[model samples]
Target: MKKSMANGIENDWPPIAASRSARNTINPIRRIVDRMKISPNPAKEMISLSIGDPTHYGNMLPPVEALEAILQAVQLPTSHGYPPSFGTLDARKAVAQFWSRSNYQVKPENVILTSGCSHALELCFDCMADPGDNILLPRPGFSLYVTLCQSLGIETRFYDLIPDENWQVNIDHLESLIDDRTRAVLINNPSNPCGAVYTAAHLRKILLVCERNHLPIIADEIYADMVFPNNEFHFLGILSENVPIVSCGGIAKRFICPGWRLGWIVVHDRHNLFKDTIQPGLIDLSSRILGPSSVTQAALSHILSETPESYFDDILHQIQSNADYFYHSLLNTPGLQPIMPQGAMYMLIRINTKDFKDIENDKDFFTKLICEESISCLPASVFGIDNFFRIVLTTPMDKTEEACQRILEFCQRHIKSVT
Candidate 1:
């Protein structure tokens, strides 16, 4: 068969990838270190106190027994199949059981699994918000929230965490940030960068505010299990009956398996707000994503089902020891003022840039320290604060001590040179 068609002159059309909203306004912090070219890759030997990645000090990696369980799951053909849209039944049940062990009465139906806590946040936002709706987040937070909401065309409003008051959430400022367009408020307890743990009393106040506003609370509790000495970890799910609460958590930081990519977002709305209003949206979103990894889901099942208190006791002991050592190191170091961290792996230090003639800001201090002292640290300016640097206490005990000495020597030399 022969067909005659009118052919038009073809013009070159450019293919564009992603929308304007998807572009990241704030770059990743690691880019600063990536831009440098050092002989023999100095980072191999340098003391890294910048990123909170646990691999720097070997805290997050699991034991051989945990690896065996994961391997066993992979070897089974049944575990290779695509999991349920919400997550595997075994995994969800395990998660529910884990909560029961913690004295919370939760069921498998309440859990929704995702790749990690970050994905859990995305799911929660997608479920709760419409385009142009705002969510309240903490100032100087993880910063990923800004990028995530921006990409989704959702807006984020910040309320300051009062650093002078042990990085507590400023309740008045938080209430002020909420409005008609606000759908939810997010809080990360045992917070990132500053290591702020919200007390039960503080969380109660937050619930009251949310109850009044008729808005849900998104509690990011990935670091829930990492509280240090004298710090109590409060689970919002226990006290979130009146107000709709979406509590996110996972075994990544707690069980040291971030690579496993198993995390969950549980709806704690006993009044059925999330079930009625939010669950449908989350279902639509989760269905399209085809759910989290099947192998990891199975691994999660095993870990959650057999959660040994001994495992956590060991981890808590190690972290407490690490925090203690790092705190003393910072206190002994000259010209650096570090607030003792109650939880998490990082501490922010006030840098006296005025004392160093060549250094003007936190970035400048970080650059020089990396080059001269062979120590890499984060500048707090990136987290909405200036003239201060953040140090990750996740490094090995010996390295922490050594880095503190090196930093002290560098400061002394800089002061002498300036004078």
Candidate 2:
């Protein structure tokens, strides 16, 4: 072995050393957040649109009932104990009841409580695919999906999500990528980064392709019910019964309580496919982890049962307003092309590199913009794309406006001379 000396949060002075695992564990989102923290902005305060948590905004708070439930749960003596590996019966039952619809009902047994949607993903990959197996994922999507799969020795192959078609999966591309070693297909609806919600018809086609390939569907619906105007959020469960679907979601986004760290994985095995294999394996995997907070799980029943539809409606409305304003403004700017988001709290704005006489690429463009405008957005290359960056629409209206205005100024400054 060579030498390891004070790299990141890993090995420090005089320590035995950091493992190779610690050296390679990188989360792109956190990387941007850390840079934003360390980078000296001449401006008073830097505005960041880099993080995905909805609760970061002061204006958006979790439901009053959910908050009260947490308070009550924290007081209960039983809340201090460890949560069961699968989850509390009440929490699992609430999940089943909340997600269950007429003719598409799921029993409490189907829900496996997890620390968060990310942990839910870890468990799904743990059960569905072994080392050396591969899974198909959406390009320009959540980097966590790729990180989680790769960390466990499970490989990932990305398929393009058609930008012009509202970020729907290119079924042809998807079908072509499948082979004997392929194990599962993962999708995020009301997609993160792209903000494109898949239509029911399109979802069916994707599911059909997976079914033909005999692979399981790992649907990351963590943005569940955050759908904005003109688009309906389709639950993957309702679309297919023949194929096995692992729907991952939590109180993080919907309830605006990401810190609560309460999430669940509901196995929709209509045909009893994963009942014996993956289902049991998920329990074993979850067992190895301490699992979600007992205090959070204790309150999950009340939170899921009582949160009003009006609460979700208001949250969606705010996301819609911010996204629309940013999209239109960026579109009108000289050196920018923004893809209007149909849902979620993100939109990818393409940097018109040809319009910039001085800037080199997306990285150079964003670095300059960050230092000059006191604003931070994630470069698209982190999510497996380039010439684009993502903006979160969860900021308050006034700040959202200010950030967009700053972005326009940056774009206008770099306008190349037209012959």
Candidate 3:
């Protein structure tokens, strides 16, 4: 061994490699997005409709109540200290009260706070299934679920969501994927890529499958209560009677504050199925990160309680208005089919590649759009779907109109000639 006199170490040291967890942890969005090496048109200003962050545009912002609460919290002596690993009692209680419905009451003990909804999901996935176990996720779903499951050494099985059916989960397909090693089902309502909201009836159908298979549910309700008029958002936990539910949520979307880094898991096990096992496991896992910021937890109560209903109404109005415009405007764009989102701040448009002259797939459409029109939207391949792209509806009306017009022109330019 060639050793140095000072360190007595081998000159040819073995190569260090990343752990299996780190190596397997791939974000499909980042991976697919990074492959687009082309630049946007310099002549036309770039309008990004890809990012999920509601705060990307200045038109939407957190309410004064939340800001005031945070201001008050930072000044308090108690807010400076570390809270319990899961969360402070007051913070947990506030979450419980906020989520509690007239028929379905949530308890503080069943709540486990984390750094953010992502952290809450990580804890839920970690606690529910061991390595080699499988979890069923939605196809065309938020890619993070696959990233987390892969990183944790858990196998991911996907169920289909029919785009024509307002992006409703194909119930038969969901149940068909379940097998002996399947541990849980992850359902994201007002889903990210699809922007589809599940009705109570539809949610009950999913719960029935879980109940039959004795599988627990990990409800990704981060966009809870964020539905447009004529549509109702149902919590799987509230609708579930027999199936135990671990619901992950936060104020990230509704409050329009993604950077707050505060979220929680609400355990809903009416029959105490998770009381001794999953509940304690989640709490134990939360200890590793020590939960969210102390000041944020301290401010949560005031933020939850004092924020007016009109604030949410205004936000919803803005999102819905954008949705309406995108749906109607893109309808005229040849080779593009825009699915009007029932809820959430996204609109998923299908690219009819066969109807286009040169557009091959979603990635091709995405590349050409940015290079030509300076409009950036996420290709749905990142979300495990093809020939579709997703756009954010949180942009101001003016920007939304501009994006629609640009997209229309781009589609028309590439669309196959009728003659």
Local distance difference test, per candidate?
0.77, 0.86, 0.93
Query: How are the candidates ranked when ordered by lDDT, highest leading?
Result: 3, 2, 1
Runs of candidate 3 with Cα error greater than 4 angstroms are 1-11
Residue 281, model 3: lDDT of 93
* Candidate 1 global lDDT: 0.77
Q: Is candidate 1 or 2 superior in TM-score?
A: 2
What tens-digit string does per-residue lDDT give for candidate 3 at 291-405?
9999999999999999999999999999999999999998888998999988988989999999999999999999999999999999999998999999999999999999889
lDDT of 2 by residue, 1-419 (tens): 34555663444335577775566567766675566534637863688787787777688999999989999999999998987898988889999999988878889999999999999998998788988899999998899987787777787899998877777888899899988999999989979989998888899998889888898899999998778776889999778868999999888988998888888899998899999998889999999877899999999999988888999899989999998899889988888889988887899988878788887777776678787887878888788888888888899998888988888888778888677
Instruction: List all candidate RMSDs to the true structure.
Output: 4.7, 3.9, 2.1
TM-score per prediction, in order, is 0.90, 0.93, 0.97
Cα-lDDT of candidate 2: 0.86
Off by over 4 Å in 1: 1-17, 24-44, 57-60, 101-103, 416-419
Tens-digit lDDT string for candidate 1 (264-321):
9877877787776687677668787767788878777666656677777777676667
Which is better, 1 or 3, measured by lDDT?
3
Which ten residues in a row are the worst by lDDT in model 1? 35-44
